[model samples]
Target: MAKIEFAWELGAHTGHVTTMLPVAAALKARGHEVRFLLREPHAAADLEGAAEIPREGAPIWSGPTINANPLNLGEILLNFGYHEAGPVKALIDAWREQLRASQAVIANVAPAAHLAARTLGIPSFEVSQGFHVPPPAMPAAPLRDWEPAPRARLEAADRRVLNSINQALAAFRGNPLTTIGDLFAGRSMLLTYPELDVYPERGPSDYYGITKSAEGKLVPDWPVGDGPRVFVYLYHYYKGLASLADALARQRCSTLALCRGVDSDIKGRHHGGSVYFAEEPMSVSRVLPQADIVICHASHQMTAQALLAGKPLLLLPTQLEQFLITRRVVRYGAGLGIAPEVNNPDYTSALTALAEGSEYASKAREFSDRYARHERGAALATMIARIEAALG
Candidate 1:
């Protein structure tokens, strides 16, 4: 059996680590030796059996924290800048060592990892949980060469971010400067949202069929009740859903709110007759199957699992991309999307429709049936096989 080393360069919460760990386990089941290189303070403890290779020891370098929060625009921009300098160089240094030992490397869509893998002449694959399409073809309005200087300034700032990323990549690989679009063009393998839930109109890629395993075993004794229950996933960074637990409680629906790393000051305010606050990662698969409806941001994993459970969703998406993903759900007749800034809008009306609407429930059931027909472990098995073949 081939010895395969997999690096989960960043692991903040359970979701970020989901893509690699399942594939690693499947490889082990297939009689291959698999090692996991992870960052410290992992959120998921189940990964203990896999050899823990620290970021400092791994051949590919990674930042101390993983940036997965979609709403932190300022943090995103700052991270883009920070990665351009220190982490990118460190990764190049690490990749040089990895090339002497390993046959290939795989990374998430982080540009620094891509650059390092390229520099070492190692085949790298990009795995993710979102769509990676080119920006939609929209009509470009002519920029006034003189007026509207603010718009031009914004454009220049955007270009600088892209330039910073490109320069770092080119510096390490000794290649001419290329646009961010060019760097992503046809270089890395793309594993994104599984095709079963995503629209079929989108073009196929090398790794589009990968599906995440259900987390049912995590919470075998999930709570159930007589009344209609709603499960809400609240991220500390996204404040749009701050009042959601209370709202569900006020409606007299049984509720469980999973708060991920929220501050102590903000906890337990939503307590009422029917609502409950759960700080731990509750088994979403168990909660989702019995949920009358789900309220969340456009977290693809949670949203996808809810759909697979035949539960209609009400998405309070906080970003442009999330809004777009929610739109896909609406287009597919599976869920509803609420703009984060629109607080006065009637979320109750949407939730009411989701819980009682026959059309919405039918669509959700259809999606669940379709997803169930596929072989459950095919995607993870395929990824392990590909990595083993690459090692060979």
Candidate 2:
């Protein structure tokens, strides 16, 4: 059995860790040794045979969100140690130590690890839900294609980030990372639906299509209520969560909220005959079908799941990444978007519009029907087959 290494260095959500678990398990079951070098290793503590190693990622950037007026996916790397060579060089050495001894690499949103794997001549696999990167051939396409940046400005930003990456490689006695595409050498299965792609200009490839939503933290326990069924996925980080929960309680709806990373007391204050909470990382797979509408920060995975279930959405985005996804959902007529900057959003009106309106539900069902042929089981089997073949 060969050794397989999985890394999730950047990105905020625990979905990164959870997405890697199935692949790790499949490999382990086949007798290949699996190790996950994760930003949040505890996320995979339950995966029996796989070892979860932490602190091997590139230095975290606690800087302002927009390190530059990012034109494309590559320019955004400036916020993640690509602004300076020292940080990248140091991380390259550290990750090289961890990776050089491994047989293969599977990465998601970890550019430094990507560089390390490339430098070591290790064949790597990339997994993403679109927007994590630009296409392999065209590395400088606009991420926010709705507000396209000038070609000159885009070129300048690409030059700056590439210089930083290459200088770091040179300082570490490694070959220069020539193009932005080098960061994603695996040519990702590019897992996402065509409509959901935030960078539409980059266009399509052998799109792996969307996978099934991972199971929720707890099994569905629907509350008893006479009102509409509304599913909510809210993390603890959003400041307006408690007030929003209160609003959902006030509304005539049977709500099942996934209070991800939330405290029990928060649920205690909100949970009642009509409102219930799951205080863990819950997937929308099981609950989406039972809901008339869904509420979330427009995370791509959750948003996609909602549409797949023909459930309309009330999108509350908290960042540019989410805002883009929210915009796509809104454009598709399947959902509505609220700006992330809003402090006291009108949750009542948003819910009313989604619940009372027929158009949103119609569009959501249209999207679901249009993509009915895309099977998650088949997509997953394809991914497994590719990984196994690469290892062979």
Q: Model 1 reaches what TM-score against the true structure?
A: 0.72
- Residues 1-392, candidate 1: write the lDDT tens digits: 65455554432445545556566566667776555444433445443333342233344343453345422222243344334555555655655555446555555434445566567666655556534323211111112222343445434443554555556666655563333334445544344444332323435545444465424233323234444688878677766455565456556777777766775554556443476666666667566776788878766667777777888888887655456567768878878888777856576677778777778878888888876765546766666666666665
**RMSD per model, one decimal:** 6.1, 3.0
Candidate 2 regions off by >4 Å? 44-71, 136-139, 145-150, 171-178, 261-266, 281-283
| Candidate 2 backbone collisions, by pair | 216-283, 217-282
Tens digits of per-residue lDDT, candidate 2, 150-252, equal: 8876667677778878887776567765567666655476777778887676564677866644454455677886768988887777888877777877885
lDDT of 1 at 90: 60
For model 1 the local lDDT of residue 192 reads 43
Q: Please list the residue runs of candidate 1 whose C-alpha ends up more than 4 Å from where it truly belongs after superposition.
A: 1-14, 28-41, 45-79, 82-91, 94-100, 132-202, 214-227, 237-242, 262-272
Clashes of each: 0, 2
Model 2 residue 262 CA deviation in Å: 3.3
Query: How far off is residue 14 in model 1, in Å?
Result: 4.2
Candidate 2 TM-score versus the reference:
0.88
